[model samples]
Target: MTHAFYVYASYGFAALVTIVVTVWTWADGRARRRELAALEAAGIRRRSARPKDSLGDGE
Candidate 1:
């Protein structure tokens, strides 16, 4: 009901949101890494491993 209460509540909500987002991002990254490792174990190669064009063109 008071101004201080509202301010503290807003800060608490923001902190909670930040923590949730950080944890989600970290977990997603770990999952992706595991998937990539599994693919590599199956002999899948990345696109960057391909040979580049002799010319300076983007194609």
Candidate 2:
């Protein structure tokens, strides 16, 4: 019964990390999609990193 503090803290920390990663991934995907859409609308027709090019080319 005396370990309730640790248990509560662990649960709180787990929730915080979960919330953080969820938000981070969501924001990242949304931003990338928006940028891609804008680029398409602007007629770039290509991502900064072309699929044909290797990752070493640059992001």
Best by TM-score: 1
lDDT of 2 at 21: 100
Which one wins on lDDT?
1
In Å, residue 17's CA in model 2 sits off its true spot by 0.5
Residues 1-59, candidate 1, lDDT per residue (tens digit)? 89999999999999999999999999999999999999889999677766676335665
Native-referenced Cα lDDT, model 2: 0.87
Q: How well does candidate 1 score on lDDT at residue 44?
A: 95
Q: Whole-model lDDT for model 1 versus the true structure? A: 0.90
Task: State how far residue 41 of model 2 sits from its true place (Å).
Answer: 0.8
Itemize residue pairs with steric clashes in candidate 1: none
> TM-score of each candidate?
0.81, 0.69
Model 2: runs farther than 4 Å from truth? 47-59
- For each predicted model, how many residue pairs clash, with residues at least 3 apart or on different chains? 0, 0
